[model samples]
Target: MIWLVIILLLLSILLYLLLVPIIVVIDTINNTYYLELKGLAKASVIEDNIEVLKIKMRILFFKFYMYPLKKMAIKKSKKTKVLKPKNERFINSKNLKRVLRVIKSFNIKKFYMNLDTGDYAANAKLYPVFSFLNFYKATNCNVNFVGENNVQLIIQNRPVRIIKSFINL
Candidate 1:
């Protein structure tokens, strides 16, 4: 009886460990995403290699997401620090069928604008603020434009699924 109980406990522990990857899959399916970094900060994308770490299941229809990138990213980035990253926001106004999230933002700075082409990049400070309120200083963010002509928009640090969208097209 004692040996059987010990074996059961070990099995449960293994199951819990496996849930991390499953949670990532579920959140990836449920959420919509985008990436945007205004300017010279945009160049940082060349060095980015982000990945999903985990997810928090709050309710059947809602979840609290988490990323750990402070030491690995924010502190390392030369531009745009203390950015406000939000995750619970939805993408389409007409359809709750899909969800959208902002993911990350950078500290404000000035960038050269190419008004005719409508594409320009900005330059931010060398150091980041590292604010506690900035999603507890996490990482795995990105920068890009998203959405369609009907509901056009721009955002940052979207999920891998959102990024894969362009490749499919």
Candidate 2:
């Protein structure tokens, strides 16, 4: 009877030791799942807000830039040279809309602005760039301003996961 009791106690201890790891693994998985769901919710909210902001920007562009440009082009006719470069002429609101559309179509997961160029813009150009950066930042998107003049923003589909895991200490 004494030996049987000792064997029973040993069995219970062994079972507990074996189950502890399984419980811990289950808890870790649950926590990871919760984090993933939270991340997805955050991403969705950001995407919706970005869409609304883009629409507002398009309206502003049409009202402020495209309509006026169209009027000026009409007034110039074919004889009066506008004297603007062909590229500059093409960089109107329509082109901006197209660029925005492309950016959206790509379903950009991450955004980074590279504004290390030495070129100084007057208030005219400065306002738009500042506004764009503000808009991007407001959307809860990640924006890294690299100090390299030739560096362009790179978008990666899985950047969020990589960044999140990397920053996890």
Candidate with top lDDT is 2
Query: Which window of 10 residues has the lowest lDDT sum in candidate 1?
Result: 38-47
Candidate 2 overall lDDT versus native: 0.36
Error of 1 at 128 (Å): 40
lDDT of 2 by residue, 1-169 (tens): 9999999999986655433211001121122111111112211111133232111112212322112112233354567656755555747886676555544432333333334344444333554666777675632212223434222222322334433344443
| Alpha-carbon TM-score of each model against the true structure | 0.18, 0.21
Candidate 2 lDDT trough over 10 residues, lowest sum: 21-30
Q: What is every candidate's alpha-carbon RMSD to the true fold?
A: 21.9, 25.4
